[model samples]
Target: MAQVLFLGGLGRSGTTLVERLLGELPGICALGEVVHLWQRDLRDDERCGCGSRFSGCTFWQRVGERAFGGWANVDVDRVHTLRDGVERTRHIPRLASAAQPAAQVREYASYYSRVYAAAAEVSGAKLVVDSSKHSALAHVLRAAGDIDLRVVHVVRDARGVAYSWTKRVARPETDGADEMTRYSPGRSALLWNAHNAAFGLLARRGVPVRRIRYEEFLADPRAAIIRLADFAGLAPRPEDLEFLRPGYADLRVGHSAAGNPMRFTVGRLPLRHDDAWMRALPPAQRRLVGAMCGPMLRAYGYPLNPQEAR
Candidate 1:
């Protein structure tokens, strides 16, 4: 009877921060981005936020050992290649089928059940955090049955997410060696629109869900954490906030040469907001974002256009 929490949203949203915060709660293990299903490989190139290679890192080693009965020796490059293939096709149904077993999908559900059990046992918590951010996976997990699951639909302003992606594209040398693609404002807005639409669809179908705004969480960390904890059936505690400070440095994973500047182990509760998107995006990009994501923006209580701000 393990509780499984699916934390999802479009990439570059505050899902990472939310994962870390949730990991601090009693008996919870936050597994960051275990999106690789067919390939179990972690290489020097793929840097997990935990400061370790996803495959060889001690943290994941223990997780694999506990969950899969042994470390399946993941290959970093192969997993990346498979991920690239999935992206190139833009076929979510195919990707979902790829994660399923031959005869029946029951085996797939069993695999996830074991994973959740192992994670909960190892973390000494009743819950596991799966931050894969794919709507298809969410659907598959729900259809698989027997897992008590809840979804946290995290959302951010489309312009803000686009601005962050711009920085990621620019800092390819620093962030990682991978040749990340730059997202046009139109594409970014569409991505946000699609992801939010998926979230809404699943939520309407009776999936237990809570929607959290990234900007609002930054504006009030304590209240936000408490609300999220409540939604996840967790009791709020002081240590959770203590572990959320910037630069506190405890969860480093791999043996990478360069440390993440954005990595803060602990510092102050509720980090400051980055409003650079308001100025960083050109007028044309801003309009594109607004125009593409207008419906979702309005659904989330954001202004549809700059003119509507006043």
Candidate 2:
């Protein structure tokens, strides 16, 4: 069975940073946001940060070879032009089930085990990182009874997440621009709340899970990295931190450049843009997010405004 590390969290919550860092670990290959199962159209014009066009990404091309047995000669331009709608609903489920069997959950585990093995072979990494960050996918992976799965539940402040969403919303048009614009602060908060809640529920049910705050991870990354290594049963190494640094340069779909300052290859790192949310977010938007996600803020150990709490 292959060792699988899942960096599960809501979008824009620093999953990419964590994924890159983990991928840096010797023998670890991290693939960014291969949420192909949820994709309605196989094509999207956006590059997946692997430096390859999504439909033509070499990493995914290899994954496709193992998954489907032969290249199949997928059309990248058509895939990019494809619209993800009704057709996706049918294909997504089939692809997901193909990766895991309903009758034999262990078969699903074996499927992922193979996937990880394939990834390791391609990237020459001992471990594989999946940054899908989807609760549903995580649930399915957990159901597979083969590999030892570790869930890294990464969280960020709701306000910060919302602010980040606002920035993305203001970006120039590209493939799936419509889908991207829909991720407002309200939506972002709901996603954060739901994802964290789902992860919490799974943890309570005895899934091998660990939670890490984006704030804490930024504040003392070495300590946080050590803790994560310990939880994953990985021996600490000097190269681990070095591997994690390059990921900060990855600016792709579902990945953010905002958190780059929090990243360091070694030694003590100072906080960067931790309070940027306060200054970046307008007073109205901040108030709205605070009011909307007050309960969640409290649950995540954030203080709600006194006036709003009442």
Candidate 3:
């Protein structure tokens, strides 16, 4: 069975840093956003975290050979069609029911199962980290029945997440021709609520869920890494985490398939909080996010008023 440590949350919630750090521990492999493996890495041929294009990355080449006889044998278009039909927020109720399979959720899930298994086999990792950051994908895997799934739900303050979504960030994995998608605070807030709620539902359904707040991690990254290592079922030895020191971590270039452009980062990576939203965000937009996020704001321990945010 495929053993997956899935990271689920809204975009810009600090998943890359956690995934990258976790890979430094023994017997764990970080796979970035495997949800985009077929389209972004296979079809478009984006850059992997190892500084090689997807086709040139020997690690992925081995995985493709192992998973589907070198990726060409797999039908990318067919998988995309199946993804649209089964792996979306609108398809959750259909996926949640163990009694139903007519929506083709199992068919789509089989593809991911193969990919995850191949990754573990190729890297010899005991657990593979998939920081897809989508609650819909998390729910799909929970209902998959064959894979062993554990979730780490990372949450950032709605105001900070709203602010991050508004800025234009470069996608180096692309040919420098496209920027990451930007979302308005109102829209980000709506997603903030929906994404967190879906992950909460996963925990209730007994999916072995753990929540990590971005603010908490920024405050004490070393402690958080130890906690996360334990959660992923790697009761890490002190030497396994030697790369980590207070306020900084020595990172390695990864062979991740897809994720935030930060996946391309290497060397001494500093861990710090980005509260740019506090100083630069217009008060009006912050309040709008606070209002739209509703009780999910408090559920994750953020104040209803942005000014009162920690």
Report the number of the highest-lDDT candidate.
3
Q: How well is each residue in 95-154 modelled by candidate 3, as lDDT tens digits?
A: 655555654677777888888899999999999999999888887776566688999999
In terms of TM-score, which candidate is strongest?
Answer: 3
Least accurate stretch of 10 residues (summed lDDT) in model 1? 252-261
> Per-model C-alpha lDDT, please?
0.64, 0.59, 0.86
Per lDDT, what order, best first?
A: 3, 1, 2
Q: Candidate 2 on 142-254: residue-level lDDT in tens?
A: 65565678889998878888887776443222333543444677777777776777777667556688888887787666567778877877777775555334213222232
Which is the better candidate, 1 or 2, if ranked by TM-score? 1
Superposition error at 95 for model 3 (Å):
1.8
Predicted structure 3, TM vs. truth: 0.96
Stretches of candidate 2 exceeding 4 Å from the true structure: 37-42, 45-48, 54-58, 71-114, 169-179, 239-271, 305-310
Model 1 Cα displacement at 280 (Å)? 0.9
Candidates 2 and 3 compared: the better one by lDDT is: 3
TM-score order, best first, reads 3, 1, 2
TM-score of each: 0.78, 0.71, 0.96
Off by over 4 Å in 3: none
Q: For residues 1-310, what per-residue lDDT tens digits would candidate 1 score against the true structure? A: 7798888788778887777667666667776555543342333334444544455456556666886667554334644543354332244444344544232344444555666776677667777877767765665566556688899999988888887777654322234445445677777777888777777776866689899999888777667778888888888667656555553324433211122233234433346777788877888888888888877888899886654532
Alpha carbon RMSD to native, model 1: 5.0
Report backbone clashes per prediction. 19, 7, 0
